[model samples]
Target: MVPLSFANQEFTLTTSGALYWPGERALLVADLHLEKSSFYAKHGQMLPPYDSRETLERIALAIRETGARRVFTLGDNFHDSEGSARLEPHAAGMLSALTRATDWVWITGNHDPHMEARAGGEIAEELEIAGMVLRHEAKAGETRPEFSGHFHPRLQISVRKRRIRRPCAVVSTSETSGGRMILPAFGALTGGMDAADPAILAAMQPAERIDAMLPAAGKLVQFPLWRREQNLV
Candidate 1:
């Protein structure tokens, strides 16, 4: 099921908990550390090397399903400077095919500010389109709404009184006057930190406006962000 929308717009930003702009026919993803597994493997951490493929596949599917013409990434597109260089041949092919026609935009993130220049896309610290601003980090002071990804938002969803701590899209209603939405990490293997994190949680209001939920196969399970103690990552 698609996640519900908070703002009334033509795009129907399906709360699939996935950041999709139906109006622009664009798919938005953030924090896709494409070669993170390889980065770890080099350090002897022994992670599955298929992360690049998996991440790209999911992104591909999302684009196809949304019929998106463009893709906007919030940041952390690569684990490090050497991430794209170490990709397995097949994974590289997958990525190549995925971006053959669609336009890709990579906003500067802390992990790789030069990603746009190095990753076959345009690079910028922030983007303003159709009255909305895009960036890697939420601007501390802004009047209009902003979209970004860095802290993968997740919630502690309760089912039958049992809590399931899972990653989710975190939107901030307080910052930017309820104009900021934090896109969840798009990396297939990336984990999230708690939305209640001091640095991240401060953006939320204590009066229960935050909507945290996990998109299960059939339902979007909702929960309060402040009540959970478990970390999303």
Candidate 2:
């Protein structure tokens, strides 16, 4: 994990893509998309069928590594509304154990907008914590510091003449709107949108600077994605 400061608060970004909030002793992850493979298999696309288990295990590992007493999932906790029902017995057991061990909050997302809290955790459309809004998606007009997930931003960079892509969080900061960070998808099966995509930039507009960040080799590797060009009044 490496220190990442945003909105005047300090956080740690784990290599596995989980964000650790030291002040709150919490772990924030986004877009679990559990059971995504099963959702695809239902449509004649047979995936490995172990996506849910893998995702659950990673979450557990993150909690253990961070020693987080609370967990906040940004959204799409499951691939679909009925995904929880399809959780394999082992994966279901693992999830139950994790929830019982910590304070878990599931924020609803487009994919699981109507998800219920029957899965052993609290449910919310959004959450306010330590002066920051935590939600599933970033609202362009929101003026407060916000932490969200939905874009699953990835940064593609060339290394040694070869191109590589890594999941990253896009951080946007502006004097008027404070700061907004969009976390990468934590699920194994989730796809990514380029961090520099116009849609992603627009979502985090009114920015002085925008950066894509990820943890690498015990350090936070930050790439400047965009900056406001100087304008004369």
Best prediction by TM-score: 2
TM-score per prediction, in order, is: 0.83, 0.97
| lDDT for each residue of candidate 1 in 74-141, tens digit (9 for 90 to 100) | 88888875677788899888777666668877776888765534336666778877777888776555
Cα error of candidate 2 at position 98, Å: 0.6
Off by over 4 Å in 2: 230-233
Q: What C-alpha lDDT values do all the predictions have?
A: 0.69, 0.92
Give, for candidate 2, the lowest lDDT window spanning 10 residues: 224-233
Q: What lDDT score is found at residue 142 in candidate 2? A: 82
Q: Can you write out model 2's per-residue Cα lDDT over 130-160, one digit (the tens) per residue?
A: 8899999988878899989999999998999
What residue runs in model 1 are displaced by over 4 Å at the alpha carbon?
1-3, 10-17, 116-119, 158-161, 174-178, 204-208, 217-221, 226-233
Clashing pairs in 2: none
lDDT of 1: 0.69
List per-candidate RMSD values in Å: 4.7, 1.4
TM-score quality measure for candidate 2: 0.97
